[model samples]
Target: MKIIVSADIGNSETKMITRYDGVEGSECFHQPSVIRKLIKSPQIAETNLKKNVINLDENLIAHITSSALNRHSDGLYVIGKKAMQTDLNKVQNMNIKLGNKHKHDIPVIMILAMIARTVVKDEFELNGALESSYQIDCDFVSAIPASEFTFEKAKEFEKRLTKGDHTVVIHLGDKKVMVGINFKKAKITQEGIPAIFAMVYDNEENDDRKVSLLDKFNEVYDEEMEPNDLLKMKIFHVDIGDGTTEYIYTNGVNPVIDACDGERRGVGHATEDAVIMLNEMLQGSFKSSRQSFMEIIKDKTHNLHSEAFNALEAAKGTQANEILEDTFEKIQNKAGNSVDLITVYGGGSIQFREHLEESLRDYAETINSKLLWVPEELAVNLNVRGLDILNRTVFSKNKK
Candidate 1:
């Protein structure tokens, strides 16, 4: 059985979805985009939990479901939730851009390995088939930020990914498994702004609804009818992420290469600001981390200390206003008059939806343009899902 995998490796999170013969399966995985080295302790190294261990050379690594742990000659490494619990200091944030030269870096290799392992597991579950040797062929579709989507950069990414076959050993649940994936082919594209494609594509799937959403959008925005007509429309697409906010203005279906912009401000920046405020409220008495604070913020049932909660709410409000203000100013300066449609997506869209909507109202009124805010749950996965749809509808046809 052949497997097609579409992966989005964002700064803060990694998401993946797998399919076979153009049909999506039940298998999907999401994890924090963090990796850390596990310091070797004589106690851990000497202990033998044979069933829960993955042996790599002379080192033995414990496999925990919530984290990624692997043993190497230098030391054992942990990733995902496990790394956060083990040692926040060891956790490395993989938010920087990696060019052709850094393909062999530990983080890059580990991410690739993780993707391969996910695909293998999905293949087994979906097809009820596994090769005796646990080897499989993969057609990978992935995306990078719009600012780095140049021909040279895209090629560099592709080259690094398709360098050769890769093998990795991982412990999932109680099983020790080794997976080898051969990159039969790979296609990488710019993602941030192009995520608008997913909203358009989803509209096409739900055409039976009372109002054809895209049709109404086109009527209001002066966009062309066909999906491929995206090239002819003027679009200002904004993707607010955890670590960065990227916006691009396109004169046609393709992005206006020079108009792409990315800033370091995002939902994460706001969260950090809030955490600082929370820490200050406690008189620096309680040490707080981003993860811990986020748990409180997200969990409606979690009882927050009154003073800390008030501080957090104030910081979030300030941060949201600032981000929207900055983003609006950039849009006004860049494509305020020329843009026909404004599209917004990504994690920040949901986090600061009220502020964004309120701010966007002014822009829409000023420009008389249509505004498309992708649904909250769909926002984060827009790019990867769009890649999957593009593969099935466009690239596959071209291959024939």
Candidate 2:
């Protein structure tokens, strides 16, 4: 069966969903947007394991191991969780860019390969197929930040991704499975705020017989509204990722591109502020590691069991509020009036939800905007979900 895959390659994580015969299948799969170069180990050479490593013509790769979660690797580099476990100094968070040019960076290639590997593995497992070399035809849909979403930029991304076939070998349990993927087509959508807007607005001009992502999101979120009415509602979409916070306005139907803007202030900024506050409170007693600090900051329920840590959380909360306040003010300045609905999504939405809500409360009366936080469980996958819907509806129709 031909499969369609939609991926949202965010700076913090990559979320993907797969579809078979135009029907969504399987739960979303996600991995950290991190990669690390492997330091050669003597044991590997002694075991003659070098031949097993899958070379991508790049310096790094997504490490596949015996774990069902694919979190281990014996390659020259590692991606995702395995990469995170490596020396913090060696692991680097990928910096995804929003521009009109293609980036041939190692992280980007690793992510693409990772997505393909994941789908191929799942398909094989479901079919109870033995481990062997197999070829699959796939159509891919992915997204970039909305601020740089243009025809030229989308074409550039598609060009990069479809230049040639890619092969990925993943070790699952004791079996080694090799997958050769031939991309039949690729669609690139604008992520961040615009993608969220697209998630809510169903375009009648596209295909009239299909349910859109907006329909799915509304159903999941328990929102009852007609598509026509939803299209008329003015919305301000706030997409807070690890590296950037994008602000976009939609007239319920189409994006108000001129009113869109982005800032580098996001969860990362708040985390840094929190770390600084904690260090000050502990008087240098609390040494912060990027990995540990990020975990604590992102997971709201993490118990650090220290007064300084609690105080640090509070400081981060306050900083998060400040960032949102600044963002709102900037949007108001450019748009003249606050929107009727303010929707928030992206990884940072869950991390900083309370602070964002608190900050919005301060301006609730003046802004007269209702907050709509994408359900916590679905926040990270919102963009890709929308892209998937677009692929099934618009792209599928175009292909026909």
Candidate 3:
């Protein structure tokens, strides 16, 4: 069976979806970009074991998980997280002097490889019917944000990924309001940045402050808030499981001012916004079996709103529709006249679609461009799709 592995490898999480012969299937996983490493007695690359010792190079054994986590015989490995979880302490002082950032790329490669291997193993077992003689298919499509994108980095990713059957790494970023597209082909195209967040911001103004639960705060803690102080306008960056949004400002002013919602400051605000949206939909009478807001994200929405269907239904009819329209308007205002297309994506894109379409429609009245609501399947994997297109152009010697 032919297999395709598509990944949107972002800072927070790396979401992966695999398909047999280019069709959707249930066999997939979303792994955090967290590697737990430990330097133990005898190094053994193990999956899901508590104390499996494995050799890192030779003398020092490193116990690694399919999650790319390694824990040492001592507690040093657990002291830090992410790329820092590795046993740099065990390495020579010279290597440590060169620093963690220098060691970052190699470890990232190892972590991704391990995760991919895990996906392969799970799929093979689940699809045991075909495991006997079926060819182990491996065509990968991975993506990185344009802000972190560079020619050399793309080449390096292409090299490491070559271990698979065939791979493509798409690079996506914003060029003004337009989405830039780069693919491996005779031709290269950089168009517009997908307006997923832009649409969200458009609806920001009219979203009953109640929806964000900030309305009570605005009233109770009544105070004239400055753009800088009361709201805490931070140039925070977020790399969702699918895409990255970096706050690029000049003299402390964001280019997409309207789109700025203070949520980019941290994962907490972003999570809170999602919760507030949920709570408001319940009309302040929501209850859930899932304990917290974070749980809502991991689980299904229907499950969370099962008890408040009527409130949710009403919320849909009123706030949801208006919010969507407002979102479209905001995206258009931000785009001005430069963009030819607005491609939308991310997990919330479907919920934001009506607004996106409305905004695109308003845009069509003046601009001669198309607003493509990349199909839901594509929405789930657009970053990978965009990255594949980028890899084609960046890696090709012909420079198409």
Candidate 1 per-residue lDDT over residues 1-400, each given as its tens digit: 4667677776666677666665644245666666665554223333333322333212323222211122342233465555555555556665443422223244344455565456445546556543433666667777766645666766666665566656654543334455666666677767674465665566654334454335544665586665555556788877887666778787765666677776666666766677677667667665544545565666667666555556666666876776677667767787656776677788778877776775785677777766767666567777776776666666545562
What is the TM-score of candidate 3?
A: 0.39
What's model 3's overall lDDT? Answer: 0.34
Model 2: how far residue 94 lies from native, Å: 1.8
User: What stretches of model 2 exceed 4 Å from their correct place?
Assistant: 22-24, 39-75, 96-107, 147-150, 173-175, 193-228, 273-292, 296-322, 362-364
Q: Whose TM-score is greatest here?
A: 1
Residues 1-400, candidate 2: write the lDDT tens digits.
4777777776666777776664545456676667665565212222222323332112124333211112234344566665665477677664433432134354344555565566545555567454466677778778666555676877877765566656665543334456666667887756664364345543542343333434544664478655466567787778888667777777865667778766665666655566677777768766644445776655667665455357556765765866677666866786677577777788788777776765664564477765566666556766776777777767766762
C-alpha local distance difference test of each model: 0.60, 0.60, 0.34
lDDT (tens digit, per residue) of candidate 3 on 1-400 = 4444445544334455555544544234443343333443223235332121121111122122221122221121221122332443332111111222112442343334433344334443565311221224344445334334444555555554442232211111110011111212212111122223222232332233223212322453364432233122322111122122321211122224333321122232234344455667668664321113334444456566443333333333443354344434544554334443333445445534553456544654456643334445434434444333333324233443
Against the hidden reference, what TM-scores do the models get? 0.75, 0.74, 0.39
C-alpha lDDT of residue 37 in model 2: 56
What residue pairs clash in candidate 2, if any at all?
Answer: 199-214
Q: Which model is ahead, 1 or 3, in terms of lDDT?
A: 1
Clashing pairs in 1: 38-76, 230-253, 231-252, 231-253
Winner by lDDT: 2
Off by over 4 Å in 1: 21-26, 40-76, 95-110, 123-133, 204-232, 285-292, 303-312, 317-322, 394-400
Model 2 vs. true fold: TM: 0.74
